[model samples]
Target: MASKPPDILLQGIDALRRVSRHMFRYRASIIAFFAVLLLIYGLYLRPPSDFPAGKTLSIPRGATLAEAARLLEEGHVVRSAHAIKIATYLFGGGTNIDAGDYRFPSPINALRIAYAITVGNFGRSFIRVTVPEGATVREIGALFALGTFTAFDYDAFLAAAKAREGFLFPDTYLFASAVTSDEVITTMQKNFLQKIGQLEPLIQSSGHSLADIVIMASLLEKEARSNETRRTIAGILWRRLEIDMPLQVDAVFGYIRGADTYSPSLEDLKIKSPYNTYLYPGLPPGPIGNPGLAAIEAAATPIASPYLYYLTDTHGIMHYSLTYEEHLKNKRKYLP
Candidate 1:
């Protein structure tokens, strides 16, 4: 084998030697070409010198990746739009960029920016807001308005949430500084569905429609504080509905007047509104406010009671009566 190398092998060795000599002759050019390529790559990865640190860049909802990159470049948050697009495509794993306000407290490279948008890293602090159990849509809007960081549109939220009064689940939510009215509405509605979904079987067997239950629960939420009292009130209210008697709940007046008073004036009670439970025979057109799980459960599983009337005294104690005269006596004793 070693006695004589094949002619082909000798030819290959000669070709390699020629190629090596050629490369050695032009090594400087090859090195310079690679060095230029690396320099360009490094520049692409670097943040712009005029980067808008401490500025917020808004990426509109439903915007494509290209649009987001353009916004970043235009806002001086990135060196180049093309570089960011390429970086996101290469590293984002085909995920859609999140839409919201992104604030940059400091300069960051293209790859970091791309990752931030792709993963929804808003780079802003979260505000913890608790929507109370009995809060109305307008009240919820006011609560969000108190947060200095939230850009929540109060009027927009009110308009959008008007029909979804009871469906907006009340809970503690940690919202980003840039949350929109639609986002808040969607989040609360989704949470309502999820929570209510768990009680679907109970609701189905209760012989009451979901709408009626929600409406009744809203009334119970304002009428009573304890779960036991809520269930008792629910029973009384349902009995009234069965007998074609007006609900006569005082809470709806507050909703009508956009006030927070449980006591309605005689003039206010005379107002002709569909929400007047004192005038209407059945449930009002819609829920007056949001209700918690306890109220909902009480409404869904009302306890059987023969009492036809009930009153909450000034001491917050509930009194139940079996006749109109007894109810009058309780009112006289409790009202003052």
Candidate 2:
């Protein structure tokens, strides 16, 4: 039998119908908003396949931003150029995106690419510049540039180096393209201070001034290519200095002639320059080369020995001689 519907049920039905009508009126707006969101998401989504999923990419020297973008897109790291720019912008503009080689896994997205460019690539583009033991400040600068820094007032560098001689640690250093010569110099000096600060007692106990240690270190540096050789060489140099004999280091002659290359000539030795130790009776006006830590240490605590002459053989091995006759024999055997 048909009975009258309850008032509450009828009211509920009416309310639902009114809400449905309102939703129909705004259907276009809802669809448009969702479509915009989809477009944005699709633009930035990384491609599924070639998305640099398994390999790191290299950004070689002189790479452009556009070229970098092309690489990322090919790797599927980014779906579109627009997406990469947007992601990079969010990652923080050109200032944030440091140019370097980057690695990306497959399915890497725009955000991942941006993050890699910003930070992950930092360690990838470094060059190692090794400053060998016994290199002078003048010598070190020359290694970086030839006549490029003719105006580079070495006065400041020399002033700093004179006080901190034999302290600049010899080691491998990593540097980015953005690094400057001044930065390198400061870094070496700082390393020197940290390293040599620990050897104050040794420098004092040797009854030698810091300059003396550096001078001895430079002399030792010229004579030794190994730790054992350095110790013995230090002894010989010390003995000659004590006896007031000519130090007669060929390196001093090379310095006088402004010669740093291999196999300096006989004529170079005869130059009447201030650095010629053969002509002058004492140490050179400056350190001959940058002295490494072992040479520096050997300079301070030399091995006690009675040998008067020592020479390196054809094999670059040293032969010690206690007398003139033995020295002549050594020269005849190895040098001849």
Candidate 3:
């Protein structure tokens, strides 16, 4: 009747119709399987829909895993408190989670979220912290506290720092927000040792001991405002000190006043701190600032020059002089 459809066309249509019927017969089972997958997804693999996500949550420094899990439940991040507790147990018992502030959406499940925080895989957003060239251990400790890392005790960290003096290399550090104070100090110490180890031969070649190199590097760090200036200043300092002249530095005065930068007061100059380079004939008892690689290298291999005097100019640039006359001229030109 339908123009007696072509024979081949008829056969194909009949086959397609049978397949469609069979598919419809299995549709309910397919839907049921999908439903189970959805449930599993919400519980273990992915987050539930229509839930507020990416809420800010901070885990205190000494907070336990149970506490973190409870906070998640309280924040409505996880629907079931009991389930989260059970999950924490199965996910390495919550002991593995690190201490830090975390941001997560409802788009992830408990296991995945816990793993993210513990293993530090949430995102790169690694915290960026810079320790300037000459920061002391106490100053370095304070920076950790400022970053919201609580496990660091200032007094304890100071003890550690003293034991590892001249070894806590100062440089920029990138770590997870949950990074501990001990970890940071340890890392710096290791770096310092490794770095100094590499420079040992150079130190020996300079006809100096390790302590001598450390002292020179410390002075170099205090004097350097730039890479080029560091080399220039190191030479002047070496030249003066070699001739029994005072290695006068203002950082010593700053140390006595518990300040890092300032114009010196008469009282500050008179303070009898061991770090008084102006008063003392040689390098201070220890370094005044944490030195970088460049300053350390400059201390080892200074620019050979005949200059004996150096001072900072009006533009903060350092000018060197070979004689008293030149030094006085530089001072008159630069000092207000």
Best by lDDT: 1
Q: lDDT for each of the candidates?
A: 0.88, 0.69, 0.71
lDDT for position 239 in model 1: 92
**Tens-place lDDT digits, model 2, residues 18-135:** 9888888689789999988877776665464555444445665565566667766775667786667666767765534556445443365676667667664542334667888877
Higher-TM-score candidate of 1 and 2:
1
lDDT of 3: 0.71
Q: For residues 214-267, write the lDDT of model 3, one tens digit per residue.
A: 767767776666767787777777777788887877756655666767678777
Model 2 regions lying over 4 Å from their true place:
1-125, 136-167, 256-261, 264-266, 323-326
Error of 3 at 188 (Å): 0.7
By TM-score, who's the top model here? 1
TM-score of every model? 0.79, 0.58, 0.62
Please list the Cα RMSD from the true structure of every candidate, rounded to 1 decimal place.
8.0, 10.3, 8.2
Better of 2 and 3 by TM-score: 3
Backbone clashes in candidate 1 total 0
> What local lDDT does model 1 show for residue 269?
77
- Off-target runs (Cα >4 Å) in candidate 1 are 1-68, 85-101, 106-111, 118-120
